[model samples]
Target: MTRRARGLSLLLLLALIGGLTALLWPAPPPIFQTRTMPLPGVLAARCDEFTPRVEEPAEGVFVAIGYDLANTIVLRTSAGNVVVDPGMDLARAALARDALLARSPGPVLAIIYTHSHIDHVGGARAWISDGPPPQIWATDAFTGHFIKQYEALRAAESRRGEHQFGRSVGPELLPCTALGPTPDLDHAGSTGARMPTHTFSGLQTLRFGDTEIELHEAHGETHDQLFVWIPARSVLLPGDNYYAAFPNLYTIRGTSPRPVRAWIDSLDRMRRLAPEHLIPSHTLPLRGRDTIAAALTDYRDAIAWVLAEVLRGANAGRDVDSLAASIGLPPQLADKPALTELYGQIDWSVRAIYGAELGWFDERPEQLYPQQDAAAREVAMMGGPPALLREVEAALARDEPRWALHLLAKLRAAGSPDPSPELNIRALQTLGEQTHNSNGRAYLLEAAIRLRRPVAPFAVAVDDELRAGLPIDLFFAAMGARLMPERAGAAHESISVHFRDTDDHYVVTVRRGVAEVVRGEPLPGTPTPLASITTDTDTWKRLALEQDSAAWALLGDHLDVDGSLLDLRRFLAYFRRGA
Candidate 1:
């Protein structure tokens, strides 16, 4: 126990601790700030519990299939078999049919829908058997949601709309705080169900032989949703009222805001039932009464906690961004398996819930007023896009990448075919290559970098991101991105210019027609052109969008023209239908 001996002992202990730390320490690698191709999806359905296994069906009655993200639920009885929320009818209908057959060979008795989501009801095709058919069930909203499939998809579609939401999640944007269940590949069978045949309101229970089923209607995930509970077995089937992962308070694609308070209360109602097992329509089932109940309780608290924090922060005058960043799960609950951000993030959910309860505006005057176009103002201030590109290039040279990136977006907006003396549409290709955040919007923005989508022959859609996250009404977004509304009022002209390879850069001029090339500036005394243009990228987009006849009038005077009538036809055709 001498001082020198103690010091040596401490050093030995430190070494041991270091070795243990290396073994146990877990942290994600350094974050990447840029977005790239092959963008990410929001959430994968958690099916760890349903790993291919077989248990003898309970005599008299057996529940053959459990629900997952893709399909609905189908249960079996000695007399007959019933299906709920059958999946996509056209594509995977057979798979769902086979799953039901595997469960039991019995007559098709009845069909029910917990709610009327497509996943809940997409597989109606399989229900057509040789015998008496199953009936369909759903809420009144079921019919409306069915008709508005395109609109309802906006929530799921945000997974694709990378550009508008800036969901081009890079390393940094990945959910790093906690990891949810990542499933192994090789899962098969009708874990996915089909659309329902019969829908109802309030609570309805049916006893198929000994099969006692209760379907209760609630509003949270969707407008008309029914959760099923089996009092006999202490097993409850709550539609999306509780996804194994956190329920989405607000989906990113878009939807009417769900009630946060209702969502919390609904989750609470399930916990109190204390089922021996709880089955989610989309995720794995919960085993054991205590575990199932506890998970559901924590879920209730998680929702409540987020809502409380969000409302508290909003009442305290915190802005949306500030509130979003501040609101998160309590640490004790954060580690819970069921409380993870698989389908939904606490931050987005909190902000969305807060906005839903309140309004989007934070009562700030600066947010209300008209705002100048950031691109046009910058282009004019910097003497045009040429100077802007020069500045961006200089930043790149100095290794100021963040600044280069910030400026790149502005330059792109400015270069929208500026047809003036200071025209420059360069820097995009280089920026696209060096970009980060491989999410969907980033890909389109990168494509916007080239003024055209990446050359199709060279670039097949690398992933869904190329088209994902694109506005559902992208014709409108394309108009905005490529438009200069003020100057181009009713000004349409089309002329072909044989852009010649010039001394320094390409020069385009009207050869035989009269049309104005917009978003570009005229350069004096240039011999050859690299690319010819009768109209600029934006004007072409605008006139094409408007289908303005004035475009033909501009073609009357041609400053430059080349190729045959067929080529012109082809060009026009390409403009009408995006390549």
Candidate 2:
């Protein structure tokens, strides 16, 4: 072949290769970087220094005034004012209210909840004192979502939540970040949460005076999440959808499986909007269409990439632990300010995706029906409790707190009598101080505190207004979860509760330390209840939830008892009343 012809062909091939590489390469990082804000501290010492400051991200949007963790967005529309995700509790709500009142004395016309989380909706009642009770709006599934969490997993969630938020640990011992203001753990549930007056399914567009607002239901952080978009201003209010740090696909505190794919799709939907100003619930807002687009695109790609890697490993027969260790964000994506592991770790995302796709079983026969106390038994065989304690102490002395914690846990589970509670407390304290993850630090410190003293039982305290509105069945289900099997003493007792107000009948049967609630009239063949109690719904709630003395209700004419009073007292004794 001629030299000239061959050179021309080689140039074309080189050009084609360069074009493919450009197309396949990860998008170049955005020219403008998103600003990084200091993490907030919930403890009193650092609370003042780390308290979140309120700022107007856009022309009319104010954020971070109510609480440090959750953002309260106050937008002044043509008609009046719109408040989004009020605050964590009454105090935080008051802070938000004062901040809003200072800027604009106008009344609030509407309150919009991004989701049903307590931090988002707990302060609803605080906003109602002014104005003609602003109309509250939320996703249609919000109420059902709240009920499911409260009824099915309240006990477990409450315990984990206390740890995740560092409620029990002092700031001097364990300094946590991004946890907003410290919440009043005891009075949290007592705070009012106004029910949504208006609910929509998917997309709802409304004209509040001259401004047109669009609400789109997007499932990401929560199943009932909704993002607000104002096309005229090009402002996007994504509640917990696009935060500063990495998205929390799986919270260590334990939560229902979040739909990772749906979460990615939600980000994609926001990216398509090309919002000029993006104000999220947890962090400072971002302005400029190009910047917002790039950030959202990157966020979506990060989540999708992690999920893809996890699925890839799963499909290749890799276990969850292996996937967690192997999968991570590529350098280009990981180094982004918005995608840092401040809140969520990539390892957690891998395990979450793997669990969501393939479920609990890792296709291993040994794990299918493994012995319940396998770890404890194995630890026992390895040298009994004393030996395990000695090893744990040695690990702690060597400055390997994580390893020490693991060994300590196994020692305790193996019924170890050595190392005492004091030693365990010291180890946990060291672990808590050394850990970087806020949730991990909180968990370890809280464990140390529990070892030092008896922790109080978690109380489910619903506001009076909310409690009155809830279905009777929900109340009974919550009560069933609080039953203490040990206190029941193997007695099989059945009690029929007749709610005169609602005309609902429920038979609660306790057998072998398990409590089961059967709705409707008693079965014909079932054993007759030992005691029958007739009460109003309010009285039932007081007895079941508020832990009010049963004698007071009977004397107050709130409850009427038939059959054995002693049997009724015995039945009630099974429940552990919180202080």
Candidate 3:
């Protein structure tokens, strides 16, 4: 054939391929096409008010009134009662259990946790009484994940957790709403979580008498998260997966990177269920399948939209800060009552997505090396402490409470002497009242209280049962994040922690001002460990948790030390206690 004829034939073939690709390109998932429904404008205004009221959405399912930030769901199945996510602590859990039993009296058959979060599982003990305990059910990852978070960051989390839940502020200053009637700041680390008798990985159908409940694992807020579907009642309990606010894609209190793609997919799965009733761990239940569907669809789209915008900017080589500043939810989704930013802000979600995709680095060369705290350094350079105090006063005078707080923080970090503690306290109080986020408000209030008066030492209250049950590896892992690199001194040291009870051994290494904990015995060819401590697990827990002083432990001869005792003392000194 002639060259021109051959070219024409090839063009035709290419056109045919393009046509097939277009046809099979898979239409955007139905969730993406969901139209935003108008929500009641008053809903946003009343979102924060918490008035506990028990309601039965289904024939046998009873939800204890919103007592705190979390809800307890009780299902009266033919076999017995199944409780999902008992409240945050013993008191809260007991309250919920009592309320549930009042409505439907029956023996507890099963207890299910949506995720490993303390608020969801911390009240598990409330369900147990003299009778045979319910068969606890949770995702297989729940216990491990729970141990990793609470054991490692208990102190730091407890401190920040108070602020996150607005426990520092009084009802007169910051009225509690979504966090229940009263926020228990002191018991943030209390772990009432019971061991799951039965654990499952993916989808599992459970039988509670004649009722069939389906559990599906979906990673959204937490990796161990699972949602329940009572097919018999056409009811869906999404736990934290779907609440009456914008999803907390990124919690400011700090968390492992939440899987956005998986979260969106989870929503899709819930939508597919077409439940006539939808109940979340937080907030009120929704009735009608269409309403539940629309709510879920809108929520999924909101998350998708934010993720897409972040990705678009990320792919364009724009930095995270730029993406966060520019990306926002479309007006339709933003205006929806169910998609409000009452709990989780939109900007935070953007930053979280960026961090999840690209990590802590913003692709800037300047960020490669560790730098001193920029805010502190700035305060120091700009006329030192007095100048910053003046600036803070000026900001407060202009009703710029947030700016004033920021300035005061910088001044405090710069080691400035307290020039006007009362004034600083007032400024913080003002800022706390003005902020909308519960966590932010709590932080400001707590700071104010600190400035005005002596603050108590932070303590983590973990029950003996819970502490003893945690894996030895988790204890070491928690230490890794709490290491105070600045206090390590100019020394390279390594120590092996041998738990006599568990027969678990780990090597804790301190080098270049950072400490890392590794499981198993020290590796060959590594620097010789300076010390090795052979101790029972309980003694180790006491030492690590700072419940017992290191000096006391050493003096009491609770642990056997090999090699330089001085080195071990110095190594233990490297971590900040109750940080």
Ranking by lDDT: 3, 2, 1
lDDT string for model 3 (480-552, tens) is 5566667765767887768777788878777767666677866664568877767787876665554664445
Candidate 2 per-residue lDDT, tens place, 495-579, comes to: 7879898788988777777777888976564568977778897776655553454556655667676676555656766765441
Which prediction has more favorable TM-score, 2 or 3? Answer: 2
lDDT of each: 0.48, 0.70, 0.71
| RMSD of each candidate relative to the true structure | 21.7, 18.8, 17.6
Best by TM-score: 2
The residue pairs in collision within model 2 are: 69-180
Give one digit per residue, the lDDT tens place, for model 1 in 1-579.
Answer: 233332222221111000000000112231234543322332222322433322222332333233222434556665787666554332344555666567667777777766765445545546657788666666655655443423324223423333322222232333211112111111211122333445667777788777787876777788777777778777777777876566677765456777778777667777777788676666556678888778888888888888888888888887888888777788888888676665566777877877787788875677787465867787789887777767776876775655665676676676555432111223332343343222222333423433432221110111122122222222222222222334334433232232132212122222222222323345453323322444333223233223232224244331222333333333232221221
Clashes of 2: 1
Off by over 4 Å in 2: 1-51, 173-176, 182-190, 369-394, 420-423, 458-463, 479-495, 509-514, 521-532, 547-557, 562-579
- List the lowest-lDDT window of 10 residues for candidate 3: 16-25
